[model samples]
Structure formats: C-alpha cells, structure tokens
Target chain A: MGRTEIIEKVNTVFRDVFDDDRLLIGEQTTAADVDGWDSLKHISLIEAVEEAFDMRFTMLEINGMKNVGEMITIIEQRVV
Target chain B: MNYTELEKNCTRSTEGFVDSCTLAVLGTGATQHLAKAVKGYAYSEGIALDVYDADYNQIDAQVLDPNSELCHKSPEFTLFWLCTEKLYEEFCQSKQRSDFADTVIQRVERYWNLVNGKFRTNILQCNFLQLDDRVFGNYGNKTADSFIFQLRKLNCLLMEKCLAHRNVFLIDFCYLQEKYGIDALRDSRMYYVAKLPICTRMLPEAAKQVVDVIKAVRGKIKKCVILDLDNTLWGGVIGDDGIENIQIGELGIGHAFTEFQMWLKELGKRGILLAVCSKNEEAAAREPFEKHPEMVLRMEDFAMFVANWEDKASNINYIQRTLNIGMDSMVFLDDNPFERSLVKSMIPEITVPDLPQDPSQYLEYIKGLNLFETASYSEADRERTRQYQEEAGRAAQQCQFSDYGEYLKSLEMTAKTEAFDSFHFSRIAQLTQRSNQFNLRTVRYTEQEIAQLAGDERHLTRYFTLSDKFGDYGLISVAVLDKQEDKTLFISEWLMSCRVLKRGMEEFIMDELIRTARDNGFDTVVGEYLPTAKNKMVADLYSRMGMQPAGGGRFTVQVKDYAMHQTYIRRQ
Candidate 1:
C-alpha cells in the first residue's frame, strides 16, 4: 500500500483503538496526541499493522515506536 | 511521528506480533500484571482488552437506571459482567423478597440478555452465584428445591443465549464453584469490598475446570467421544474376569455398559474418530472386542488401538503418531482416575472428561458434551465409518507387502480435483477448523466468507478427496486459489487432514492446482503462509515441494518449473 493509503488505514485503526471516531493520525502524531492511547493499547496498534499489511515486525522496531513517522518508515521498508 | 506515518510504516511489516496470547483478567489487585498482559495480547494478536470496572459501586443503579450514562453508550464489547454475589446477598438478605426480587430479577435479566444477545461480543461476568453463607443455611426442602430450580434455570438460560455469539467465551466460574466449595469465594484476594471472588491462585482446586475451558477455545471440540474399556465398556476386567465372565448382554450392569458402548460406536460412525487405549492384557482386551458376539464395539470398529501396559499417554502418543494426527485430536478415557490423571498431566492437549461416579451416568456424560457441532455433513462424511474400516483393512493387508512402492501400486489410487460446490463445501470448512499438523496458513474462515470466495471469479476453492481399493478419505484436503493480474495463482489456504497426508494427496492437489493455473493463463503458482503453533509441521512444505522461496517462505514456481512425472508413493 502507498503512503497515503497506509495513512488512511492507520487513521481508521487509531479511531478504533482510541474508541473515538474523531481521532485522526498524521505523520507527526505521537501517543500523547490521543487519550487512552496508553501502554495497554500500544501493542494493539502494532498488531493491527501486521494484520492489515500481512507483515511482521520485530521487537526492536516496535519498542521505539515514538511517532507515526518511525512506524511508517519501517512499514515502507517491509512492503518494498 | 504522526499517526499517518506510524500506520504507513507499521502496515508494511513482514512479521506478526508477539508469541502466545494469554487473556489475564486483572482481579481488583494485580492491575499492573493485568495491564502488561493486555498490552502483550494486543501487541501479539492485535486486540487485547481489560475490565473497565463498570458498576463498581451501584450495579443495580447502573443496570436499572434507564437514563444512566452507561446505558446510552453502547460498548464495542462489554468487558465485564458484574455477577455480584454480594449484591444478590444484600438484596436477598434484606428479609424481603417482596422488596427487591421483581426489580432485581428484571434488571439482571436485561443485563444478561444485552450481553449474550450479541455473538462475537463477550461479557466476562464473574459468575459468583452461590449458596455461600446465608442461603446454604437451613431451608425447608420445598424452598431449597425452588431456589435451586430457579438458579439453575437462570444459568442454563444465560448459557444458551451466550452460545449465539461465535466468540462468546464463558470463563467458567461456575465450574470453579463445583470444584472448590463456595466458601473459597470469601478469599480476600478474590473478594474485597462488594466483590465476591474466586480465582486460579486462591482456589487451586478449581483451576483446571476454568483453565481447560479457556484453552479449549483455541479450537473446536476436535475429538468426539473417548471410548473406555473394562468397567466403562465391558462391565468387568477382561484379564481378571475372563472373557466368559465379562458382561456384554444380560441383566443389571451388562445392559448399562452395552448401551454406553453402542452410543460411542454411533458417535464414531458419524465422522468422529474412535480409538481405544486400555490397560488390559492383549488377548483379554481383544477377546471381547473380536470374538464376543454380544459386544457393542468390535475389533475393526476403532480407528486406532492401544491395549498395551505403558502409560496411557505413551500408548495414546503411539496411536496419534500411527494415525499421523495431533494428540488434541483424540479424547482418552479410562475407568481409573490414576490413568486419567497420568494422561492429563502428560498430554495436556487431549480432552480427559471426568468419568461419572455411577455406571449409569456414563451415557449422560457422553451426551452432555454436545461433541457433534457440525450443522452440515458432506456426501463423504456419511461414509466415514465404512471408510475407517477400509483404512484398517488396508493397514492389515499392507503388512504382507515389504515394499512401499508395490503396496502403493496395488491400491491404484486416483488423483482428481473437484471444484468448490455444495458437495464439498462443509467438508472444506471442517478441514480448515479441524486440520492442525499439516496446515501451513491455517486460516480459519466462516461459512459465509467461504461461500463468497467459492462464488467469486477471482478465487477458486477446491477440495481433494482421495480414494483407492481400501476406501475413500472423503474431501480430506482443501486449497483456496487466488488470481493476480498476470494470471498468477496464489495459494491462500492449503491444508490436508493428517490421515490423508502420507498418501501423496498433497502433491496430487498441487499438481492439479498448477495445471488449473496454467490452463487459466497464469504464469506462476505461489504458496503463502501465516504462522500458527499447531501448524509448524508445514513450515517447510513449500520449499520441500521444490518451489524456490520468493521471500519469507513465500515460494513461487513458474509453470515451466512444474513436474507431474512423479508416481504416487506411500509407505505401506
């Protein structure tokens, strides 16, 4: 999936996870941007990524997931 | 990073989340461990949730108040059901059935109905129904009878409603109460304030009953009925009692054993694999099954046999291996709890149902399980009994032939693939859910999704049913085909029942799929896999089939790369 397509997908997952339909994700968005996006749900965000893309992520990459930018970079590498 | 960027990056990952997922309910304490576990499940399985502590103070108010905030906010999944034994106690202990029974019953009924009405959504209610302190006190026989009747009816009604949801999981606290007496619910860790608690840690005895139910949800009940020997089937020990002394058909205990064995035979005759694991002398065990005219189960009836003196687990393992299937695929039964415990400790996967105390309770135990859950059976499944008998016949005859190749030639096996139709639909559905060891992707699907895929032009689902002179292993394998722009055929789901694995039926299906892809103007055939624990046996299936791994176990072979010259070879 392209960056734009991936962004839309991420936004949908974010809304679902945060239980707030209005929640939208962007390149610079961080965990602090959304309420209830705590350590409990951080793993769900990662899992949703793998299922949506049919891909796998290592612990090293997932642990450093500070912002959407870093996560997208890794996903880009995987798709290619 | 922005959410968009995170989604973009994460979307392209080539691996799935963490390893195993264990749903840990955070009791009032241990919130930290529970949070970490939920995070782990989410990270691993994509979604993990914990109790939000709704109805913390006023459960009745939260439930009964029509304009309550929670009543309006429809939850995605109702996390916890507040089955407050304390609440029930408070209401009942008020010295007034007239004061709250009508209102309490109404609200409780509505709360249960709301949760169970939706399938795929679960309400993890702490099933704290009990006769704990005041209720278990002296009551007239009539009053106690009515109380038990109403409570049991409510439980049955709640369970029936919960069954509607495919994902509805009953974390059985009721079973816990059965194992551990109700007073254990008073443990401080499990119960504090208004909470009446029972847990695996506090109530160690009730652990298995609760843990087993959760673990079993990993797959459907794969094994049907576990056939027992001696007192369970034949009324007496064959070795000690002798064949003539064994009860088969007569008065008293003979009739009970006969009826139970016949019921088990019927279960096996209907696609449920039947096997025996008895700790009796060989002739003594064989005599009743083989020569006794009144016996319900015969020698040729059972699919796998183990009458040796080894641990039941070891013998069961041998039977499972010889049959080439998972241990979870068999249910082991014995008259002795020692043997039962041995197998339970050794093979945690097999379902070891508790043998009833009385001999008459045997049939009730078997019927209570509801093992046969399949709504539909294919043409092939109807002939399962005869097919198993034939497989046994083949097994016996193959002993005479030394060479595996010669034995293979004698069977004259045919390799033909049938396109997806109503005929093979349910069987294909079963293979996906039932098959474990031989599955690569091991993708489970609902019947609706399967129907759409089968009807679509872009996908072709096919099942391979193998047969020879012995008998037909009906629709024992399934493969879902996907089409790419350049006529590339992608293997979405591929699995074979382990019973049919050694017969080269996998290669046969692959050859046919490759041919179908070629005829459809496809250039290459690809094998795709999604990881699962029970399906590790097929991790190298694609590479072993001579297809080059395109990447991460995705093997794509060109039509020119395909070869069909191989003769079907199976070990005798």
Candidate 2:
C-alpha cells in the first residue's frame, strides 16, 4: 500500500474509533484533532490500527508517534 | 475476535436498559477496556448493564471503603482482575515460598470477606497463572517449595476457597494462558506505558468469560444440542460406510469422533438435551447405535432422533417441536457447510457454529463457542436427558388414546409437590431463570433471592415434580404466591417447563393455588400474565386457566366458588 492509500485506510480506523464518520485524518492529525481520542480510546485506536494493518506495534513505537503521518509511515514499513 | 471488531461491536449502543444489572470491575491496572469489552458482549446477549470500572489499583480502596462508587452503585456482580505480574512481584518479595501461598490465600480471603460483608454481589476473581521462568526450568515441578509449585498450589487453594464460599467464583487465568500463550495474554511494554494488565488484542476473549458468567446467571443459557449424525458424530456416512467401517472408535482418526461423542455425552449428563437431526435412512442411522461395539452415545441417550431424507432445517424444526423448546435454546452442529448454512438462514435464532474442515478440530471449535452456559448445577441436571427421553415416550403414548384427558389419566401421573426447601431451591432458581416460554411474569431471581423468598412466611413458594410410568420430570413447576391485604393472594410467579405443558399441569397448578389460598384463609386468588417478547405463547394463560380478567393483565378467582379443576395428576 502506498502513502495515500495508507492514509485513507488509517482515516477509516480513526473515524471508527472516535465514532465520527466525517473524521478526516491528515499528516498533521493528532489525538487532539479527534473527538473522543482520550488516553483510554487512544489505546483502542492504536489496537484498531494494528489490527487494520495486520501488524503488531511496540509500546515505544506507539508512544513515539506524534501524528498520523508517522504512524502511517511505521505501518507502511511493517506491511512491506 | 480482536479488539477492533469488539470495539466496533461496542459502538452499537443499547439504550434505556431494561433487564439491567450492575457490575463493578476492580483490577490492579487499566480495566476500562475490560468494561468496554464486557458491555459489547453484554449487549449481544440482550443485557443492558451499568458497569463501574474502578480507578487503576483501587480494588482495595473501592471494595473496603463504604463511600466508594462501588458501594454506591451496589452492583449485582463484582469482578476482581489481578494479573500474574502483580502476584509474581509479591512472590519475589516474600521470604519463604511456602509461606507465600498462605499469605496470598489470606489476602484473597480478606478481600472476599470485605466484599461479601460490605455488599451482596457475587465476586468473580482470577487465579494466578505461573510465570514462565527458565531459572528453575522444567525442574520447578519437582521442587516442593518453588515459586511455580506454590503458585500452582495457590490456584488450587483459591478454587477450594471459592467453592466453600457461596458468593465467590473463579476466573481461570491458567486456562486463558493455555489457550493463548502467556506472552500473548500479557504485554510488558503496554503494562509499563498504560498500566493495562491484559493486552488489547486479548481483552475480548478474557472479557467473554466474564460476560458468559453474567449471561448464565441471567438465564440466557442454551438448553439443547441438535446434532447431525453422518460425518459429524462419526467420520463417514453410515449408509456407505457400515457400522464397522465408520470411524468412531478409540483408534486413528476415529479417536476424534469418539472424543466428540464423549463430550456430547458429558453435556447430556449436565442437563443439556441432545437430539439428532440427520438426513439419512432411519435404519442406517440406527445401525451405528445398535451394532457398533464402541458407540458411546446409545439410542436411549437422544431425546428425539429424526432420521429421514428431509432437509436439515425441517429436521431441526421437527426436533424443536418434539423437544418443545425454543429455537434460541438449541444449537445445531453439522459438518457440511451447506447444511449448517441452511439451518442458519432458516432458523436464525439457533446457534450454528462454523465447523472446521478436519474432524479433529470439532471438539476444540465447539468448546470455544461456549454454547451451553449455566450458573448453577444440581442432581436434577444429571437426569435432564433421561427425563426428556421419557417425555418423548409419553408423547408417543398419547397418540394411542383418542381423548387427551383420558390419555393423561392413563399415564397414572403423580406429582410430588413441596414448599421451597433446601433440597430443591437450586433447581427452582435455575428453572425460574431459564424457563421463558411458559413463564407468566417472567421475573428472574438469583439463588440468594430465591432463598430469601423461600424463608419468608408471608410468601407461599412451591415447586412440583411430576412422575409417571414413563419417568420423572424433576421439579417441572414453580409457584410463588404473595399475600396482599384484604384476604387476597396474588400469583407473583407461575412458570412450568414446556415439556409438561399440554399434560394438564396448568389445571393442576391452578387447583393447587386455589387450595393453598383457601388453606391460608384467603378469599380471593389473583394471577398475572406479563407480556415479554419471548413469552407470547402464554399471554392468555390467566384466562385459559379459568381466572376472571380483572384488568391490566390481572385475573381473579373467588376461592369460595372455585372448584378444584379436574386433572390426571394426583398429589403424591
């Protein structure tokens, strides 16, 4: 999957986890940008992203990601 | 079964919580995900719950303090989730490994007592899973005072303590560890980051165990197993492969089928009814049970065996009719995907698990389904299959007599009825929770509630067990009469097993109620028939039993004018 495809797929997961269908996630999108992306839902969002990408994310990798673009980059690396 | 799918399921909200119960989760680490997983599973089981997830590592404070949210919520169920990591930490700090077991047991007992003394809810606590330590390696089992050995011992002690206490239940962390490896169940990195003991990927599975307990207690248990014979109960077709050729014994691939039959047989002994719905010749189907030397399930084991060329769905319908149980209470297992799909599309209520391609996976697959869940078990459960089989015989006998009343009389049925006592309280409570079809005022009560009602003098509670030449239907009917003001007694609960429905038990119960009302110096007997989605069959039960409608689902009978309804069943 390319960067744009990964971004589109990742946005779907974000929209689902936040329960916001109109959610548009971009390179600069962070937890603060989503509606219900608190500490608890953040775990669920990361878990959902991992499942959607069919890969496991380490705690360091999950905590280190500052925005959606970095997470997508990591997902692309793992998918390859 | 991943967290993502579970989270999606959780998104489907069920509002305004009718049939609601409260649950409090007290864990050492992050437990909000557990609550979410539980809510998702609970909604699927038709339960709207109010779940309280205590703050991380506040199990002690929440359980001990009277001012805590748990005390205010007063949940009906309390779940204590302490992971093995916490126990291992405690073990590492202990001076003696042998003494660690006692310390752990004492600590658990303190929590159990504190919760039990403070609240009335049932506590579900986890048993510690021994950590995979290679320091002692495989030699840990041989060491009497090793940490692994003591942890194993501690688990046993915890189980014994739970069994001794009426309100405590054990969650088998070891079972989960075995199913999914310990590493999969735990994530050290996540634990350090978020204080979550169980990994998100594995939360749904663990949460399901707790949800199943809640379902069992709430009377959503599956009662019957509708099985397919060819390639399901055995390896191959009975028509093509003779009884000798069909693989079903204790050798090779046949062992899988044998083990599957054994599992089904054990379920039969545990009060789950078994029926055969097969598409095959009757003689060919009967051959395996009759001629095979190693057959575990005999012809007598099945309540109803439908062997014909009809479609699988129609056969299942026939089986449901013969057993007189709701379709939701039945599980149909077939090896062929087409047959399974046919049953699924036709009877959407029946649970049809997706069977694996290989026969060996059948047992494990069904075990994972957790179709048959029950909160309480008694001696009555063991005889459930036999009683159903006998009821089938009675049904067959009724065809011989032209008149239904005469047929009932010919059976020479006698009922042993008694007030709610120690011996039958558990079964009575089980029936009240599980019986949905014939239930009037379908009110579910826990064993604790049943015990209180049984002991109260103001309430007259009775359970009736019917027996005939065919066999015994153990504790088939329950009645709870509440005495109101002005010499009137109200029927708060009136439910009977569907198996004994058309056999004049209703009239017998009405007669018994009238007699009890007169004996208690009451002039009027009132009855109620509440409407629930599953209990439409008994909507007009009050009027059918000769009670005059008194408006608002209420009916009345003047005890002075009430004559004993003639019935075939005589009191023993």
Candidate 3:
C-alpha cells in the first residue's frame, strides 16, 4: 500500500473508534487535534488500526509515535 | 461483541427497563473498561446495571472503611477483581514464599467477612488467571515456591473458601484463560501502559462471565435443552440410515457423536431436563435409543420425546407448554442451519446456538457458550429425570380414565407434611428461588435465612413431600406462616413445584394451613397474592380457597368458618 492509501485507511479507523463519521485526519494531525482521544481511547485506536492494517506495532513504536505522520510511516514501512 | 461495540452499547439509553440492579466493582488494577463492558452487556440482556467503579487499587480502602463510597452505595452485588500480576509482585517481596497462598487467602477471608458483615450483598470475586512466569520452566508444577504453583494453589484455595461461604461466588477467570489462550487473554503492552489486566479484545467475554453469574443468581436460568435427533444427536439421518448404519459409537465420526451424547447425559444428571424433538417416524427415532448397543443416551434419559412430521418450531412450542416452563428457559440445538433459523425466527425468546458444521466441533462449541450456568444444586437435582418420567407416566394414565377424580384415586398419593427441619434446608431454599409460576408471592430466601426462620419461635414452617405408586416428588412444597397479633396467622409464603400442580396439592396445603392456625389458637387465616410476569396463574388462589378479599391483594378467612378442602392425598 502507498502512503496516501494507508493514511486514508487510518483515517477510517479513527472515525470508527471515535464513533464519529466525519473525523478526517492528515499527516500532521496529533492527539491534540482529536477529541476524546485520551490515553484509554488511544489503546482502542491502536488496536483498531492494527486490525485494519493487518499489522502489529511494537511496544516502543506504540509509545513513541508523535503524530499521524509517524503512525503512517510505521504502516508504510511494514505493509509493503 | 467486541470491545468497541460494547463501548458503543454503553451510550445507549436504558429508558424503559423494568428490572435494574446495582453493582460495585473494585479491582487492584484499572477496571473502568471492565465496568463499562459489564454495564453494556447487562443492557443487552435487558437489565439496567448501575455500576459504581471504585478508584484503581482501592479494594482494601473501599471494603474496610465503613463510610467509603462502596458502603454508601451498598450495591446488591460487589465484584472484587484481584489480578495475578499484582499478586506476583507481592509474592516476590514476601519473605515466606511457601505460605504466599495462605497469606492471601487469609486477607481475602477478612475482606469477605468485613463486607458481608456490613450489608447483605452477593460477593463475586475473580479467581486468579493461571499465568506461568516460567522461571522454573516445566519444573514449576512440582516446585512449591514457584509463581505458577502458588497461583494455582491460590485459585484452589479460593474455591474452597467460596464453597464454605454462602454469599461468595467466583468468576472462573482461569477457565477463561484456558478457553481463549493466555496470549489472547492478556496484553503485556496494554498491561504495562494502562494497568489493565484483561486485554481489550477479551473484555466482552469477561463481562459475559460476570453477567452470567448475576443472571443465574437472579433466578434467570436455562432449565431444559431441546435436541434435534437426525444429524444432531447422531451422525446421519436415522430414518434414511438404519440404526445399525448410523454413526454413534466407537467408530471414526461416531466417537464425536458418542461424546456429545455423553455430555448431554452429564447435563441431564446435573438437573437440566432433556427432550427430543425430531422430524421422523416415531418408530424410526426410537430405534437407536432403544436397540442400539453403542448409544450413550437411552430413552429413559429424556423427560419428553416427540417424533412426528411436524415442524421443529411447533414441536418445541408443544414441549415448552407440556413442560410448563418459559420459552426463555429452554435451549434448542440442531445441526441444520435451516431448521435453526426457522426456530429462531418463530420463537424469539428461546436460545438457539449456531452449531458449527463439523460434528467434531459441536461439543467444544457448546461448552464454550456455557449455556447451563446455575447458582445452586441439591441432592434432589440427581432425581429430576426420574420425576419427569413419572410425570409423563401420570399424564399417559390420565388419558386412560375419563374422570380426573378417578385418575387421582388410582394413583393413591400420600404426602408427608412436617415442620421445616435441618435435613431439607438446602432444597427448601432452592425451591424458594426456583418456583415462579405457582408462587403466590415471589420472595426468595437464602439457606441462612431459611435456617433462621426454622429456629424462630414466632414463625410456623412446613415442607411437604409427595409420593405415589410411580415415584417420589421429594420436598415439593414450602409454606411459612407468621403469627400476627390480634389472633391472625399470615401466610408469608406459599409456593409449590409446577410438576405437582393440579393434583390437589394446593387444597391439601390450604387444609394444613387452616389446621395449623386453629391448633395455634389463631382466629383468622390470611393470605396474599402478589402478581409477577410469571406468577399470574395463582392470582385468584386465595379466593379459590374460600377466603374473603380484604383489599390490597390480601384475603382473610375465619379459622372456625373454614371447612376442610377435599384432597386425594392422605397425610403420612
């Protein structure tokens, strides 16, 4: 999958986990950019993303991600 | 349901729920998600759950302090989730590693006593998940001080304690870990990051385990399993394949069906009624259970058996009516998806599991669903099948005689009525919880309360047992009479087993009640009928027994004016 395609799929997962249909995401979107994206919900978001992308993020990778750009970078490196 | 779906369910409004329960959850780790899952799952089961989640790792503070939020809320049910990971940290720091389980059990007993002493609540404590740190590798099983050994010992200790304590029950967390592998049950990353013991993927299943216990305690239980015969109880269609050709015994696929029948037989022994509803000639369906040498289940094992060309839904409806149980308390199992869907569409209240295609996977799948969860069992449970079989015999003979009075006389029934004693306390309490349809006022009592009533001087208690030429209906009816001031005797409880209904049992009981009132020097006998969704059958019971309506669902009859009701049962 390309970076743009991964970003679009990731955005769908975010919308689902947050229970918001119109939740869109970009490369620079951080935790601050989303509502109800606290630490507890972050775990649900990670699980939903792993299920959607069919890949697992390492513990360090999960704890170190800074933005949607970093998440997409990990998915990009692992998907192809 | 998944974690996200359960989370979404929590947002739904429980606006019109008629039944609601209060629950308090305290755990040594993060339990907010678990509380949410339990509340959401209870909503699906039509129970509005009001959950009070204690702050993380406050089990001691909340249970010990009388003025804590837990004591103030005083939930009907309190859950203690003591995880193994937290216990392991304490185990590592303890100097006496060999006595770690002992120490923990002592503390657990203290907590139970403290909470139960403060208020009357059902305590649901989670057993430790059997996690092996693998420090001693395979040798951990034999090592006394190993974490795995101590953890398993702690689980066993919890079971023994729960068995001794009447109010304590265990959530089989170890069994859950065994069902879905430990890898799926626990997430190391999530545990470390969030202090959540159970993984997000497994939260719904854990919540289901909790809610199942609560449901059983609240008298919502499955009492019967309706089975399909052709491909369900055996390998092939018995009508097409003769009894000799059907796969049932020690063969390749036959072994699977045999094991399945064995499991059903075990459930039947455990007080669950079994009935066969099949679409075939009656002779053909009886051939295997009657003549086959390798069949595990016999004809005598079933409470009722119906084989005809009728549709499965209609046959199941007949079984439910004949058995006199609610449709919600029956489970139907069929290997054919078409038949399953038809029954499901027709009867929306019955539980019909989507059985797996492979015959080998049938038993495992059914076991995983845990359909037969129960809150109590007694010695009477083992004789249930025989009682139902006797009931069937009575039904068959009733058709032989045109007059019901002749049939009752032919049976020659005799009943033993005596004051409540120590020998039958367990069964008496079980009847108070189990009987619903014939119950005048549905009031549940625990064995402890029943014992207290038996010893109290102001109360008069009687337990009745019936036996005829066919068999014995042991401890079938219970009545508690409270002596009121002003020469009045109040009937606080009157409930009989549905199996003994319409057999002059109620008449016999009313005679005994009036006799007891006269012997005790009470002037008037009073009774009440409080209606429930299931107990409408006895709404006019007081009036039927010649008691005058005293308003507010109460009835009164002077002891001197009450004539003895005629009954076929001669007192023993």
Candidate 4:
C-alpha cells in the first residue's frame, strides 16, 4: 500500500477502534487523539494493524508511539 | 459515528459487550403466553423455571391402562407404564420392566442435573403430583426425617441429571404449591390453568415462560421503586398526626406502609438503588424514616434523597442527576396518581409501578414483580445499597464549603487515570457490561476482550478512580480514549459511578484527557452519545462542558480552547 493507502488503513483502524467515522488522520494521531481510546484498546488496535499490514511492532517500538505521527512512522518503517 | 461501525461493534464483533443479565426468575408457570414470554426472555437473558404435571390422572391412565400407546415405546417408555397411580411403587417392585429400570432412572436423573446447572433456562412446571402420591402427599408409612432425606436426594440427584448438559432449568412448582397451597397459586399472575381442574389450573406454560424469564433476566434493570415518609412510611403523616398518633405494628393501615417499606428496603438490598423522593418537608419524612420506632428503612438504606417543594418530575430529575442514573433507572412511587401521571408525562423514562388502590395487596403486588432479573449478579449487588449510602454521605459532606471549587478542593479528591491493568480489568470490563446511566457510549465488553484490549496498543483503555477525605471510590469510572489523528480524540466509552455522579469526576477525567491531548499538541477531542433508557444524564454532558452536539446528542469537548478545571487536582 502507498502512503495514502497506509493512512487510509490506519484511519479505518482508528474509526473501528474508537467507533468514530469523522476521526481525522493527520501525520501525528496517537492514543491521545481519539475518544474511547485507552490502554485496554491500544494494544489490540496495534495488533490488528500489525496483522492487517503483515507487520510487527516490538515492545520498545510499540511504547515508542508517542503520537499519531510517531505511530505512522513506526508502521511505515515496518512496512518497508 | 457510523451506523455500520456501531453494527459491526455490536453484531459482527462481540468484543466490548458482556451480555449481563439482570433477573433470574424461579417459578413454575406453563402456558403459551408464559412460554412465549419465556422464549422471548431467554433470547434476551437467562431463566430458571419449574415443570409439574396435574392430576396423576394422566400418569394414572398412562400406567394402569394397557392401551396406553407409550407402554411399549422401548423399555425407556416403561417409566410411562409406571406413570399410573396404581403401578408406581408396584412397578418399582415389579419384574415386568426390570430390564429398562436402570435406563429410565438415568433419564429421570437428567432433570435433576439441569435444575442444578448454570445457564438454567428457567423452570418448566407441568402439574402437581397427586396428593395421595409419594412426591406430593405425606409418605404415610415413611418417617418425616427419611422423607426429607429422600427429597434432598431426589432433588439434588435429579438436578445433576436434568441440568447435565442442556443448561436448562427445572422450577420447583411443587415446593411452592405445597408450601403456600393451591389457593395462593390461583392469585399468582404467573400461573395459568391448563386442564380439567377448573380452579386449580395446570401451569402448562412453564416450558415457554422459562425461556422468556431467562431473556428478561439478561439485561440490566435500570429503574427502582423509591418510597416516601409520614403516611407513606407509617399509618399517618407524622407532621399531621404526631409520632405517638402514627399507627404502626400489627394494626390496620399502619402495618401496611411498614410492610411496604420492608419490601422497598429489601429491593434496595438486592442491588436496586432506592431513592427517597418525598413531597413532605425534610423533618416530617426524615423523622419517621429515621426515628420511627417501627420503621424498617434507616436513612442509610436509601441511595438518593430529594426532599423539598418541587414537582415530582423535577425531584425525580434531580435524583436522576444526583445519582448519575438515567430517567429510565428510576421508578417513582407515591400515593397520588396525579403526581405519578404528571411525572410520567414529564419524564416518560421513569417507570411508575402501579400502586394498589388498597394497601392490603402492596406486599403481594411488589413480590410478584420480576423486574430485578439480570444475567449477572456479583457481590457488588449486596454492596450496592452500602455504596449508594456512602455516596450520599460523600455528597452531604461536600456541603460544608461556601464555594463549589473550594468544596471540590477540600474533598482532597484524587483521581488516578491509567491504562487497564490486571487488577482493574475485571471491573473496567464490568463498567462496559453494566453502566447504563452516565455512559457516553454504551459498549459492553467481556473480560477476555478487555485483556485483548490491554495487550493491543492501537486501542487504549483507561480507568479513573475518585477519592476524597470521605472515602476512596476504588476504580469507579472508566474512559475509552482512542486515537483518530494526531490531534483528535474519539471517546468510545465514558462512565462514572452513580455514587460519584455529581462529583465532577467525569469533568475531571475529561479535563485530564484534554490536558493529555493538549500536552501532546492535539487540537480536538470527539465524543458520541448513543441513547439508552438509563443514560440521559450525560446526553448534554458534552454540551455542558462546551462541546456542541455534532448530531443528535453526539458531540466533542475540544482541547485547544478548553481550559482544564484546576479545582480537581489530578493524582495521575
């Protein structure tokens, strides 16, 4: 998937995880970006994305996602 | 919010919702109507019913008559052969069906298993065993102690067998019928007649009722019946008649309200939040409820109290706000139908249990109600009364300060917000499962899914705990904040305890959420409101906090312009 495609897939993950459609997809969306987005949901959405994109996130990298921008960067790095 | 996403969450993925049942009815009524109710309720929750057969005549005919078709229906049908009034014990002693006796006993054993099993559908009742027979009548020759022992053995053994694999239930219609007698059964709303015994009808609907009660028992029951004082608590209003003049104890209408109070209090003890929405001035109502020698409910028995000159609907609304419960969670009770009708028209969600015109049937009427059934009952149910009492105390303590902010500060309120850990996951999951009133989004969840959510970083689950000098509320609130973009927060679920409804804990949590978002350069926070009968308190929660409704009641509290309230000092 291209960058836009990746963002679209991640946005769908965001929309699905938070149950929101108008969820914006900037370069910096993070756990703090959405409502109903908390720790109990965070890991599953990541795992879902990891499975969806055939990518994996390490504990260090997973913890490293400080913002949406950081999440996209990490997912992008893994995708490549 | 998208309907498709909501559908996917509810239908496609059963991740966040635990089907928490509210009531578990145990009765032995069988009719098509009862059956339909049973089936419908079962689809919704869980049920436990009993089955009995009337007039050993059917069994008698089956047994003594050789022409009975089931006589030769395999050796298993030999039990049918023994169904005759004459052949029961004789068949037990006979060699005619000795070959099939073991298998038949094993099949009969299955009913016992289902009776004792979990996921019991409800009881299916047929008819009472004949008065002359061993199951119903005095085992004439047998000792009472031995009969009791035999009954225990029979019931438990049968429970083990019947509830064995099907997760079905067997109601003990025989027990109650024997205890209260058939006369009382005639008055029961649940029982219906199915056979030749005109007055003593067959509860043939037991099969279907079990299904309906089970389903009805599945979801949470939001509303509860709350009582008043003076004549409401005793025979006459204390203010009008004085304490000594108030009639109570085993006398006339005095005993009536006393009995009614006992019933209301009992419901409170059973996880129902009982509020006192009395029209009387505080001293009159509170005096009898508190100091009346014959009073059943103490001040601590009630969850919320609204005592002032106000319309009943307005008082109810205040109680709804104070409890952080929805209009549907409240069932208002007063002697006046005008007030009841007025409140009913004003707030349609608040249920009004029909008050008997005569005080004699109050106890019996309340007893017949199956409103309290639900899929799950934890220790929290027993503690609910205590919790609400404690919440009331906490609110009362907040009154000492002249300024609201000063009062909030004086409470030494500490709120801890964090990701779900093993310690709080079960309860966090429970909030998703049970919270109806203040919840922003009513998404129920299972423990396993909670664990899965904890393990997944893409979804974040956080719990909020509120405590002041009064007491710590443990983990009473939870919020599901998800990432939408770098700057947008999509709120999935937000709920605070009914105990701490007015404590501004939700606001504290929102403020913290926005602070977290702002600290990270987020611009806006999104929230949704999916209306349930019990959560209208938070319908305008976002709007009150500055977020306009996007559509319907769905809205967002933004971060950039929103100034976090400094009154609530965050511990986290």
What is the lDDT of every predicted structure here? 0.61, 0.84, 0.91, 0.56
DockQ of each: 0.01, 0.55, 0.61, 0.01
Ranking by lDDT: 3, 2, 1, 4
Task: Please give, for residues B18-55, the per-residue lDDT of candidate 4 as tens digits.
Answer: 34322222212222223223323333332222212222
Chain B TM-score of model 1, please? 0.64
Looking at model 4 chain B, report the run of 10 residues with the lowest lDDT sum. B74-83
List the pairs of residues colliding in candidate 3.
Answer: none
Please name the candidate that would achieve the greatest DockQ relative to the true structure. 3
Residue ranges of candidate 3 with Cα displaced over 4 Å: A26-33, B452-459, B482-489
lDDT of 4 by residue, A1-80 (tens): 56777888888877765667788877866667677566535544654576578876666665566877777777777786
Deviation of model 4 at A67, angstroms: 80
Interface RMSD of 3: 0.9
Winner on lDDT (2 vs 3): 3
Q: Which model scores highest in lDDT?
A: 3
Assess candidate 1 and give its lDDT: 0.61
Worst 10 residues of 2 chain B by lDDT: B1-10
Candidate 1 local lDDT, B1-572, one digit each (tens): 22223222322333543322333232322232222333332332232222233433444454456565445443323434334454455555555433243444455556656533432222343443544333544442235333443454455655665544343445555664664556643344224321334421233222322333332333444553455588878777888888888887867778888888888777776667787788877777788888888887887677766677887778877777766666656677677788789889998888787888678887777565534445334465556656666776888878989997787788888755777785555566656767777887877654434666789988877777677877666677788888876768899888888776656666777777888888888898889766676778788888777788888768889988787636563312
Per residue, candidate 3 scores C-alpha lDDT tens digits across B267-374 of 999999999999999999998999999999999999999999999999999999888888989999999999999999999999999999999999999998888887
Show where candidate 4 strays beyond 4 Å: A1-80, B1-218, B250-253, B307-310, B382-406, B416-430, B445-463, B479-494, B498-572
TM-score of 1: 0.57
Clashing residue pairs, candidate 2?
none
Residue B472 Cα positional deviation in candidate 3, in Å, after optimal superposition:
0.6
